[model samples]
Target: MAESLKDKVALVTGAASGIGLATARALIGAGARAVMADRDAAALERLAGELGDAAIPLVTDLLDPDSCAAMIPDALERAGRIDILHCNAGTYIGGDLTETDPAAIDRMLNLNVNAVMKNVHAVIPHMTGRGSGDIIVTCSVAGHFPVPWEPVYSGSKWAITCFVQTMRRQLNKKGIRVGQVSPGPVISALLADWPEENLRKAKESGSLIEPEEISDAILYMLTRPRNVTIRDMIVLPTNFDI
Candidate 1:
């Protein structure tokens, strides 16, 4: 039997745009209340407004350990409980290792790796107490395979993949589901910083996927029977070579 999101409350990070935004919208459509969390305050507010009463915006800076720790509690305060947590807030740094800025690398690791751990730490007790919850992470194909152009970004994602797998084992007995969606070249703000030539090449080749495709995969994971967990989903455009 499939699970239903009706009356459930989901907290989604990076909900201002891309896969996060699309997933939040889909959750709302499935009758779940959404807590949209993002650093972009104005965009978060606007999107939440568009989503109406079903959506609540929570401004969060994933770079701050305190802020990441506070997100789950803040969502709980607003919605009473968080049935789902989508740890999707992340930045991408694309370039050869020699050309990448140290600060940019730090920022990527901070958000993609540290923030994920902090957010998970904050939510675990609550979810375990309830004995039922879902944690979905946005990983990347780059995590599974090496990408010369974005080694640091790939490293961050690889860290997340390992984290998710380990946490799944640890939390399975607690009745909490932990899973990750690894997407290949989604057309989102993450790519906005990519080299113009590479971005243009990818676009021209039709290798970029829409954010909605990733959201659809997330919904599938969420709707599966409680006994059936989709541990990892890899979403990519058919035209995508890597």
Candidate 2:
């Protein structure tokens, strides 16, 4: 760890688990003090304990605008300023578009897209005022290539991909860097504990990816020079053709 992020403050959503947790760890290891926000209160508390005092935990429901609003300010209060915002919270419900329940689609959209926008609304002003900051979004390879059985998830990821790219263009002049990291299939509690048959299918079909691999990619993006922003990253295991 070269301490590229020394003197910086980072806020990572979905910090209690998976990709978000990995990103938070990477940021903290690189010398940034991180504020972790998540809806899972119990898990968030446990993660906070393990991360020690440098990691601040905020229990926030991404669906709640007010919760999102409180995160950055609280982080600033504790760490002085926010230099990085990682919008990595998301959800998925697998189904063919025609067969998927509308309610499930809405939940997926709300968590995947709306939450990111809400955080951006709350945090970008501080970044703009300071004339610099970094935003890293967790999208998916499904955003680039569709997965038939997971139509809704694909749609949500595609939306994130588009949003991140637009944000990059919109904030470039302000020295605010926006980037996105897409992982093909990560073995996390979410995917690992998926219905047994689905897990078997994924294994048989060879679609598993490692969480640490994606974490490394995220670190690479964050460590790039101030003039550089990793517009998009797509990481997939060689086993899965997609």
How many clashes does each candidate structure show, in the order listed?
Answer: 0, 0
Give per-residue CA lDDT, model 1, range 1-242, as digits (tens): 77899999999999999999999999999999999999999998788778899999999998877787788889999999999999999999988999989998999899999999889889999999999999999999998998888889999999999999999999999999999999999989999888898889889989899999999999999999999999999998898887
Residue 107 deviation, candidate 2, in Å? Answer: 1.2
RMSD of each: 0.9, 2.1
- The residue-level lDDT of candidate 2 at 116 comes to 90
- Model 2 quality (TM-score): 0.92
Off by over 4 Å in 1: none
Give the whole-model CA lDDT for all candidates, comma-separated.
0.93, 0.83
